[model samples]
Target: MKVAALDIDGTLYPGALGLQLLQALTANGISDKSKSEDVFKVVEKYHFNEIDFQTMATSAYTLFAEAIAGISQAVMQCIARQVWQQERTKLFPFVPKLIDILNSQGYSLVLISGSPDEIVCCLAEEFGISKYQGSIFATHQGKYTGKVNLLSGSLGKKYSIFLQMIKDWRVNLEESLAIGDSITDTALLQ
Candidate 1:
């Protein structure tokens, strides 16, 4: 049950593309531009208060989820993939070395992200991470299907999938480590 979880946005990468995207949306004069700023404001408010990582992460997730709700899955995937490829320039310097070390030590590595699966998968591969885990809320066939599948977020991220991984691999949590840079990951770390 040696598990290690890594957060994608600020934890893995240096800059916040999510916030940048929000700014872009506002600059472009997209409808309801203020909503984007409001989300960032919420995030900033939490950060200013020195909120715990889990709470901050949850708030960030909520912001993203709300903003992405009405968008089509295809568009969401495109946006996520594009942002990851174009906007992100640097990752934590220790990420690659740490993953290798953890793998050698027989610790299972899990990349849990609130970002879309398409984006997270790309990052995992780029970082040479062998396995991937995370959630993307999306629809199919260019329709806004109300139901969203959990690619790897919230409870599914912290417990369900992690537990299943342990059960399938016959490992124990005592030997596991979860690493993340957000408040949302507090649950997984605990």
Candidate 2:
């Protein structure tokens, strides 16, 4: 099968889903607002092109993971839905058109993001894309265990996931296309 590997942050949408989820958690008092300020600062730097994608992504992921270390699965899911509702309307005009074009061309769309699985699932559902991957947090007793899977499917882990996807899905590399806004997308693009 031919594939269209897609990135969500800055590719499909204007902002980061992880950040939106983090903000929602903090707003709901699940995480401390003071702790989130640093993550936001890094994001601001990223927005101004002051830092490369890798650095910004790493910093944001670290901060977000630390903040949501103990949240329950149910709570995270509820907040993820709320985030999706708010972010759905802010997608780039090109995204829908691009998806349609790719679909018509027989490219199987696959979303790979650095955001949490909950939010990634929401995005996949919104776009009707079945095959996707995102950060997988470790949990114990239905709560976050302060640990993330080594293969979280974004940033440093993206290439491995992309390779696995290619193998599993039997993707035709010559006929496939990849779109992303950062160095994180290098593996898929390459």
Candidate 3:
């Protein structure tokens, strides 16, 4: 079996899902009314503090994560579905055609994305794709516990998983193809 690993954000879609999620937050009133001004203020503060760009970005993401940490799994799933369904037209133009070609060629399709498993699964279902072979990372209950459970993402995406898939499906790695558009995906492809 030939395996094809594809990245969802920027690769399958025309843009990043993070931007879409931010848009969703704004649309759903999750964002603060002064979000833009507040972001600028935060940037200025960081600059004044001599914080590097990486540190500033990390700090911002950490705050965002903390804010959403309390969100329930069901809510996350709902938000994901709403965003994808409503914005499907914004997906990359060649995605569907590529998927069809790969599917017709008897290639095993694997979607490896940083997005949560629920969202990925929903998108796969929407596109008539079979069950995902990748792992999804998510938190259970209210506590993040700072640990990610491989439900699907970086941790779940490993050579070991690919090896297992090969054994289970009797596929040869030599014939497998891994595709991704981010540096994070290098490990899996390598």
- Best candidate according to lDDT: 2
Candidate 2's TM-score reads 0.89
Top model number, TM-score: 2
Sort by TM-score, top down from the best: 2, 3, 1
- Give the per-residue lDDT digits (tens) of candidate 2, residues 1-190: 9988899988898978877998899999997576677889888898899998778777776776667778898999999999999998899988888988999999998888987889989989988999888888788899887666643534556767877766767777898888988767876677
Worst 10-residue lDDT window, candidate 3: 143-152
Candidate 3 lDDT tens digits, 65-176:
4444545656656787888787678878888888898888888887666555656676688777664543333466743332345523343345555565456676776787
User: Which regions in candidate 1 have their CA more than 4 angstroms from the true location?
Assistant: 15-32, 50-63, 128-131, 138-140, 143-157
Error of 2 at 76 (Å): 0.6
* Model 1, C-alpha of 170: deviation from truth (Å): 1.1
lDDT of 1: 0.62
Off by over 4 Å in 2: 45-55, 150-156
Q: Which regions of candidate 3 are displaced past 4 Å?
A: 30-64, 133-138, 142-147, 150-167
Question: What are the models' TM-scores?
Answer: 0.69, 0.89, 0.70
RMSD of 1: 4.0
- Counting clashing residue pairs in each candidate, in order, gives 16, 0, 4
Evaluate all candidate structures by whole-model CA lDDT and list the values in order: 0.62, 0.82, 0.60
Record all residue pairs in model 3 with backbone atoms less than 3 Å apart, i.e. clashing. 135-152, 136-151, 136-152, 137-152
